[model samples]
Target: MRAVIGIGNPGRNYIGTRHNVGFYILDSFAHKNKLDFLPTKSDFWKAESVIDTFRFLLIKPTTYVNNSGLVINELIDNFNLTMNDLLVIYDDVNLDIGNIRIRKNGSDGGHNGIKSIIYHLQSDSFPRIRVGVGKQKDDESLANYVLSKFNKDEINLIDQKIPLLEQLMIEFIANGYEKMLDYFSKESNTNSSNLS
Candidate 1:
């Protein structure tokens, strides 16, 4: 089985914040699939779904983003999942808004959430989707910027891209990261050709 963990703070106050994009994407995907997240006895809520013959779980950590690894570690053990069976989705301030980058494995790149997960898991061998939420201004504190809501235009841009993000996740569920990366590469080339 595979699992996709969406990292974010839990609660109403974080709903529209850039730091909550991971939760937003998972929520959208669950809603579209008619899956409802149910609270577990642990530190997360999960929606289970099957795509083709693949069974996967969509997880939202109930803990704050900085402590996300604790929840992920628990789930990994409970489900008997390996690093290859997990896919993490979270926001990246380094990329421009509306962009997303996928990777099989890597360092945290300064994300506390990823850093925590790495520290707990003791390896960077999982797949991840980094959704762009735009960089913080030089004058602003990174925490304040990430915890803030997006402007109307920024929100709309992300909304438009959510469908594609959902589809990309479906690909991850049905295949491993290699095939998913292939699909993304083809899609990117096609999109680039159309713009040229």
Candidate 2:
């Protein structure tokens, strides 16, 4: 079993903020696969779907971003899953907009959600997919910047990128991380030539 946990604040107020891109990506994946993420008794919006032999649990925590670990830790313990079986997808302000980085393990790098997960899991060995939200100008407050919605131009780019992310998730589950990385790393060139 594998778990794909997308971290973000839960509420209508946070609907389209950069911080909620993780939820958007996961929602896209679930929608593409015909999976419904109805709320469960565990206080998470979750859905079960299988890609080949891998059974995946797609989770969006209702505990909000800062307290995300509460639900994640519960899922980990209840499922008896190891760190390797988990893949987190979240926004990263440090990365350039529209870029993504996949890592097997790493520190939270100042993400409150990731920090909470690390605190609860007591380890930093889980795999993660970091989606770039871009850094704010020096004059902008980090909180305000992250909570802001994307501009029309940025939305157009994100519209294209989301499907690619959905494909990557499918490939990551069906094949493995390396193959998914290879495909996504060269996505621009492939897309230019009309190849998926």
Candidate 3:
């Protein structure tokens, strides 16, 4: 079984904010699949689904982003899930708007949510997808920028990208990270060649 955890603060106030893109992706995916997130006694809302016979869990921690790891640690223990069976999705200030970067394992890159995960897990050997929310302006504080909502154009761009992001998540579930990476890379090359 695989678990996909989207990192974001829980509550209506956080909706549509840059920091909540992780939750946004999971919500969109669940809606598309006709699944509903059921509240757990634990610190998360979970939706379970089977795609192409692969069982996976969609998780949204009820805890705030900075403490996301608490939920993950609990999940790992209770569900018997290893780090390799997990995929974390979160926002990144370092990436340009609507861009995504996937990695098999790495440091948190100063993301508080990721830092918490690493702190609790005691390891970073897991797959992750980072959604880009764009860099903050020089004068804008990091907290302010991340918590801010996207403008009209930015929202449009994000909406356009959601379909592909959904495809990537599906790919991740149907195949492991290495296979997913290679498959998407080849698909990208094929599309580029066709365009050329």
What would the per-residue lDDT of candidate 2 be over residues 1-196, giving only the tens digit for each residue?
8788998888899988899888989988887789998898896899897887888889999988888888877887888877777788998899766677788778999899999999888888887888888899999999998899888887666666777788878777776677777877688565662222
Q: What TM-score, over all chains together, does every model reach?
A: 0.96, 0.90, 0.94
lDDT score for candidate 3 against the true structure: 0.88
Error of 1 at 17 (Å): 0.4
Clashes of 3: 0
Candidate 1, lDDT over the whole model: 0.89
In candidate 2, clashing pairs total 0
Clashing pairs in 2: none
| Candidate 2 lDDT trough over 10 residues, lowest sum | 187-196
Local distance difference test values of all predictions, in order:
0.89, 0.83, 0.88
Off by over 4 Å in 1: 193-196
Per-residue lDDT of 110 in model 1: 92
**Tens-digit lDDT string for candidate 3 (1-196):** 8899999989999999999999999999999999999999999999998999999999999889999999887898888888988989899999878777788888999899999999898988889988888999999999999999989898787787788778888888988788767766776676632110
Go through the candidates in order and give the clash count of each.
0, 0, 0
Q: In candidate 3, which residue ranges exceed 4 Å CA deviation? A: 191-196
- Quote the lDDT for 32 in model 3: 95
Clashing pairs in 3: none
